[model samples]
Target: MRRIRRSIGEYINLYNGKRPHSSLADQTPDEAHFGTVRAINSGA
Candidate 1:
């Protein structure tokens, strides 16, 4: 159970922090939430 929980947590972190989603215009959840997506594309 503990191992499963750890795996879930890691996946959650990756999902929210690292993985990009097409629904969010290929931005990670954190980037979409913080409005950093434009900055990334505009090269600012």
Candidate 2:
């Protein structure tokens, strides 16, 4: 059970952090979200 949960968690992380989405202009979700935050914080 623990192994299955771990596998699912890893896949979720990979999907969000590594896989790019076409709707986001080919950026991974994390990159798309955090990049915008960084840009805003930098006042760029």
Query: Which candidate achieves the best lDDT against the true structure?
Result: 2
lDDT of 2 by residue, 1-44 (tens): 99999999999999999999999999999999999999999999
Off by over 4 Å in 1: 36-44
- CA shift of 18, model 1, Å: 0.7
**Which candidate comes out best when scored by TM-score?**
2
> Residue-wise lDDT of candidate 1 within 1-44, one digit each (tens)?
99999999999999999999999999999989877767877888
Colliding residue pairs in candidate 2: none
Query: What are the lDDT scores of the predictions, listed in order?
Result: 0.92, 0.98
Q: Quote the lDDT for 29 in model 2.
A: 97
Candidate 2 regions off by >4 Å? none
User: How good is model 1 by TM-score?
Assistant: 0.66
- For model 1 the local lDDT of residue 26 reads 97
Candidate 2, residue 2: Cα displacement in angstroms equals 1.1
